[model samples]
Target: MLQTYAMVVNRNKNRTKLSTSSVEKNINVVNTVKNPSNENINKMEQSKKPAKRIIGTKIMEHVKLQPDKIIMKKKVFCLSNVKKCHRDDVVEFLQSSGINVITCFPVIKRTDENDPKAINNDEHSTMFRVCVEKKDEGKMKDPEVMLQHIIVREWKFNEKKLDFKNG
Candidate 1:
């Protein structure tokens, strides 16, 4: 009776090992089917490349069709009375105040000889040309209101005229 019991225990252990091995093989086959190999993944990525290229080309074509619309979206403004500040200092000050200055230069205004306030020397002032986006153009129209710290003598929006020559 003792021998028969020992033989039964050994048989159960062997059966358990065989079943576990078969289960591991089945799991490997399922994983392979669900997750593709590297080569298959590469092929799928290559197939998606052309679709992305087509989308990029469509965007470029749309931009080319309406070039004037893009030009109208941005406005240029000339800011005067920069207080004879250096070019770098003016740019840094404007940048600190959240103003995007495109170009800056010192402008010498000719003084009128007849005017009582006119000086003998040329009046030097720094001028800044800034490109403002359409969304912010309205707010930036009044430099005195927008830039409270800076002394603004004059502010004006630059007008751009399109000239087309007919052959």
Candidate 2:
């Protein structure tokens, strides 16, 4: 009976050793599959990603291509009290006053119902919408101070001009 008990203990020890070695071999195989050499990892990283294009870099390239053209921002303005002011005369006047006016045209109102400040149905006064370069925006305010019987108001983008009273 003692000999039989010793044989059972020896069999358990051998089974434990076999299981531990099998576990170690599995761990080594998994590590080798998951992580390759450092040189292989670098090559895989390079092949996986393509070269990226930056937006600012592309814009700069176009800007660099045009050397002669001066990039100027556009600004809009509302010129009021243009009762007898001709479009050509106004353009010439603005240009002469150091205001670089790109374009100016009369803003004709179809009806007085839209405008609350309209005194009467026939009280639609001649107004002009003017567009100029951003650098010449300061010149728009000058027309109000320099010219008589004319109101100059800077029009903001995507915003409605509420005040239409001649100042």
Most accurate candidate by lDDT:
2
Backbone clashes in model 1, listed as residue pairs: none
Candidate 2, superposed: residue stretches over 4 Å from native: 1-64, 67-70, 112-125, 143-145, 156-167
Task: Evaluate residue 113 in candidate 2 and report its C-alpha lDDT on the 0 to 100 scale.
Answer: 44
Worst 10 residues of 1 by lDDT: 51-60
lDDT of each: 0.56, 0.71
Clashing pairs in 2: none
Worst 10 residues of 2 by lDDT: 53-62
In model 1, where do residues sit more than 4 Å from their true spots?
Answer: 1-72, 111-124, 142-167
Candidate 1 differs from the real structure by a C-alpha RMSD in angstroms, to one decimal, of 22.7
Candidate 1 per-residue lDDT, tens place, 4-32, comes to 44434556756534545777999988987
Error of 1 at 145 (Å): 7.0
